[model samples]
Target: MIALGVWQLQRKGEKEALLALYERNRAMSSLATYPELPPVPDELLFRKSSVVCLDPVRWDPRSGTDVKGRSGFRMIADCRTGAEGPGVLVDVGISDDFTPPAWTGGIVQGTVVPGPEQPTLVERLTGRAVAARPMLVADQPVAGLRQSAIPSGADVPNNHLAYAVQWFLFALAALTIYIFAVRRRLRQ
Candidate 1:
C-alpha cells in the first residue's frame, strides 16, 4: 500500500512537470521567425519568420456536428515554395477558409507562432452563408485581405489536476482494501 501511494505521487509529479513545460512553451513569444526560405518546413513544424502560402483546397467545417459521429469540417491546403516545388498537405480547422484558389492567390506573412492556435481561422459553417462561404485554411487570409487572429495557448493543457486526483484516489482504495484483508486474516 505504501509503495503504491509512492508510485502515485511520482506519477502526479511527472504529470505536473509535463503541464509546466507546456505552459512555459505557450507563454513564449508567438514569433513566426524562420531562417529557411521557400523550401517548406515539416508540417506543423515551422519556425519564426517563415512564409507559407496555401493552394486552393476544400475541407469540412469545425462547428457542425457530424451525422457519422464526427464533428469539424476538413480543409486541405498545399504547402510549398515558389510555383512548382515540394508541397505538403495542411489540414486546418473548419472555422478556417480552405477554398479553391481564386484569380488572386492568398498570401499570409507573420511570425510562426508555435501551437495549433498560432494561426486562428474563422468561418460560418451553418446557415445561409455557409454554402456561399469560403473555407478558411490555416494559412489563408481571413475576411478579405485581413490578418488572421491567433488563439492564446491558455486552455491547451486541461484537466491535469482532476486526472491526478482520480489516480490518487484509485491508489488509496487499493491500499485500503489490502489493509482490510490483511487485518481480517490476522484476526482469524
Candidate 2:
C-alpha cells in the first residue's frame, strides 16, 4: 500500500509537469510567420497561425461551443499555404444558426489542432469531409457566428493528486490495523 501511494505521488508530479509543458506551448506565438507551411512539430499543437483558404468553406454540423458557452456548429474549410499546394482543414468558428455563411475564401488566422471526430449523434450534421489531417482552429469569428473556443491543456482533469491521497490513506489504515492485531496477540 505504501509503495502504491509513492507511485501515485510520482504519477501526480509527472501529470503536473505535462500540463505545464502544454501551457507553455499554447502560450507561444503563432507559426504564421512562415512563408510556407512548415512541417508541424508535435509541440505546435494549439499554436496560433494564419493560412489562405483554397476551397469553399464547409460546415461541419458537429456541435461546438463558444467561450461564452453558446452552442453551435463549427465552420470548417480547406486552406492552402500557396496557390498550387495541397490544403489543410481549418475550423473558422461556431454558428448558432444553421444557415451557411457567404464566405468564399481568403486568408484566416487561428490555432492548429487535431481534427475532432464527426459527431455521431446527429447523422445529418456530417457534411462534405476535407482531406486535411491536422485541422486549424480559426481565431476570428465567422460573419454570423462567434469564435470557437480553443481547447486548453488546463481543461484536462488531473485526478492523480486525489488518487495519491486515497492510496496514502489506505496505507495508513492498513498499518494501524496491523498494529492493533499485534497488540491483541501479545495480550492473549
TM-score of every candidate: 0.46, 0.62
* Residue lDDT tens for model 1, 104-183: 22454433333222222343333322212111224443333222333323434455455556767887898899999999
The list of candidate 2 runs beyond 4 A from truth reads 1-11, 32-42, 80-86, 118-132, 162-188
Per-candidate Cα lDDT values, in order, are 0.41, 0.72
lDDT of 2 by residue, 1-188 (tens): 77777888899898888778778878898884423333444576667777777666355556789878888887776555466765667777888776667777778887777666433545545664432256777788768778888877676678987888898899889899999999999999
How many clashes show up in model 1? 23
